[model samples]
Target chain A: MALSAFILIEVAGDHTKSAFKTIQRISGVKAVYTVSGSYDLIVQVETENLQTLSDLLLSKIRAVDGVTKTNTCLVLNV
Target chain B: MALSAFILIEVAGDHTKSAFKTIQRISGVKAVYTVSGSYDLIVQVETENLQTLSDLLLSKIRAVDGVTKTNTCLVLNV
Candidate 1:
């Protein structure tokens, strides 16, 4: 089954724009938006399974230069 | 300026679909999605400002049949 998740991200200093640009270009990232509040960005990602989701987070998203923190909210029903 | 926010919602019982359907039709609600997380659904809303956003949430969103709780995360940059 295809699984999806929304990742809430926090960046260091003022790298939100940079992080947004880089993240949007990444595969699996269906949508990315820069927002305020506690998180700098909210990203919607589509993946085949949990494994792929994990890899995308660890290897692609979290690996971004300005990304400081991340919280993953997996879509359960959809 | 137009302000947008993502509202995280929790609905009563199995009313997610019902709430989703109703919420999506509301004036200021740009998008609503059913998901599995700390909150059941995530809704994107756009309005003229915080006051209008508040009015939409209080009058339209909170009035939905199954909606029980809501948390708003305002978009800062975008």
Candidate 2:
């Protein structure tokens, strides 16, 4: 089954535009949008399973420059 | 321009399944999913502008039965 999450991102500097460009290219990221709120970006990501989701967050998302903190909310099937 | 948001919903009872069904049918709602976390559901909605988005949240989403609280994160353009 596919696993999806909304990864709320906080960027360190005034690099929202450049950061968004780089983030949109990540493999598992479906979409990324800058938002007018506490969070700088709203990222939609989907992976095959939880493990892949975890990897995507750690290896890809976190590694990106300008990203400071992340709050991941996993989508559950009910 | 299209305005989109991720509305985090909290349900009052064991009505997640029913809530999801009702929420999905609302106009402007792109998707609704039961999610694992503080929020019971992740509702994706898109409207023509911020006013329409506000109307959707008040007249449509908040009106749904079993939904207690909502935290809306407006999607911003970068």
Candidate 3:
């Protein structure tokens, strides 16, 4: 089964397309999209387990060049 | 001065209207709105400090009926 998570990220620069591309390449990431108002980007990621999800975010998503901050919400159910 | 926070809340029932009213009544809550996809409700709260904001959510907002889960996003700037 895949664990779903919604990641709300803040980027320092206007590299929306690049950020989306980078997040797509990360393991376990399912989808990414731009949101209006408050948050810059919303990413949907799926993983086999929570630990793997966290690891992928720490090592990959957070390490992306323009990403300034990230807040993750683990989806408990549909 | 004020600190802004975006709160993502999950409701067990279809009580979107009631949730918005209850959250708006909270001391530090600035605005509340419904968003599409993933999370059910998004609330914007402004407080004098982070601790006050946390307190408001824990004491008042979270205690409201119908709210199943809540995740807070603190806005650092803009």
Candidate 4:
């Protein structure tokens, strides 16, 4: 089963555009949106399992320059 | 452009299943997931504009039995 999650991202000021560009390049990221809220970006990502999902979140997505925090909500019943 | 959003919902105890059934019946809701986290469900909804989206969230989605709180993230750049 494919695991899909929405990552609510908060980035440092002045890094929004650059962070958006970098996040889109990450593997399995289906969509990235710059939004108006407490969070700056909402990212839709998919991976084969929970392990890969965590890897993407911790290593790839959070590693982007502007991203300060990521709140991940994994889809349980789709 | 069609406006889309993800609503992170927290519900009352033991109301998950009933709420899930009730939510999917709502007009604009595209997908509903039972998730494990601070929030219990993740709902994907689409409307013609922000006004309609807000109406759906406030009037329809939050009105469901179990749903106690909703945090909406509107898609700005998709």
Candidate 5:
């Protein structure tokens, strides 16, 4: 089963372009999109399980130079 | 002094209309806006402190009928 997640990321400054490039390179990321307000970026990712998803985020996405903080929401389903 | 927080909310289904109404009614909400992809909604709120913001989210916003999950990001100075 694929576990889907949405990640809300806060960047250091007006680094949307750089941050977007970094996030797109991360594995397990299904899609990345920009939003109008508040958070700088929103990303959709799919993984086998929650643990792997957590690991990927911690080790990869969060480690990007421009990203300051991240919040993850697991898609429960409709 | 005030603390600014960005809230990422996931709804049970496609209840954007109802959810927006419920969120706007909550106190301390600065602005709420819809995003283009991934997460359903993004809200900007200002509070006296972190605890008050947390309380508002838990006791009020999160308690709304259609809300499924929320993740908050405290804004740090740029």
Candidate 6:
């Protein structure tokens, strides 16, 4: 089954738009929404499994230009 | 503009299914997905505005039978 998750992102400086665009283009990201609260955005992601989910977060999401923090809430089912 | 949010919920005991069903019926709850990690479910909510969102969370969602905790991340735009 595919792994699904929601990533809560915190961007640094004035990079919300740029970071949003970059994060949306990532291969496994399904949807990205700008939100208000403790975090700036919510990203819905799908991956092959736990390993891929981790790699996607570390190598892709966190690598986005202004993404300073990420908190992932993994979906339990496919 | 409508207010949107993702509510992370924590269910108590064996009430996941029951809590999910009850929550889905609430007026402003748009979608609900069972998830793992720190939260048990992620509920997509849409309300008329911030005040309505607050009322829904405080008066409805928190009042669900098995919902022990709720963390709301309100969507920015309609």
* C-alpha lDDT score of every prediction, in listed order: 0.88, 0.87, 0.75, 0.87, 0.77, 0.86
Q: What would the per-residue lDDT of candidate 3 be over residues B1-78, giving only the tens digit for each residue?
A: 577767888877778778777777787777676654567776767889868987888988889888888877665431
Better of 2 and 3 by DockQ: 2
lDDT of 2 by residue, B7-55 (tens): 8888998988899999999999998878776678888899998889889
Clashing pairs in 2: A34-B76, A35-B76
lDDT of 6 by residue, B1-78 (tens): 777789989999878888888888999899888877778888999999889989999999999998999888877652
lDDT of 5 at B55: 91
Per-residue alpha-carbon lDDT of model 2 for A1-78, expressed as tens digits? 898898888898897788899999999999898886677888989999889998999999998889999988888767
The number of clashing residue pairs in model 6 is: 1
| DockQ, all models | 0.55, 0.66, 0.05, 0.58, 0.05, 0.61
lDDT of 4 by residue, B3-78 (tens): 9888888999989888888999999999888887677888889999878997998899988998898888777763
Per residue, candidate 4 scores C-alpha lDDT tens digits across A6-72 of 8888999889899999999999999888887677898889999889998999999989998999988
Better of 5 and 6 by DockQ: 6
TM-scores of chain A across the candidates, in order, are 0.96, 0.94, 0.86, 0.95, 0.89, 0.92
Model 3 over residues A1-78: C-alpha lDDT tens digits? 667677888877777668877887787877676654457776768888868887888988999878998877665432
Model 5 chain B, poorest ten-residue lDDT window?
B31-40
TM-score of chain A, cand. 3: 0.86
Best by DockQ: 2
Q: TM-score for candidate 4, please give it.
A: 0.89
In candidate 5, position B46 carries an lDDT of 90
Question: Given candidate 3, what's the lDDT at residue B69?
Answer: 87
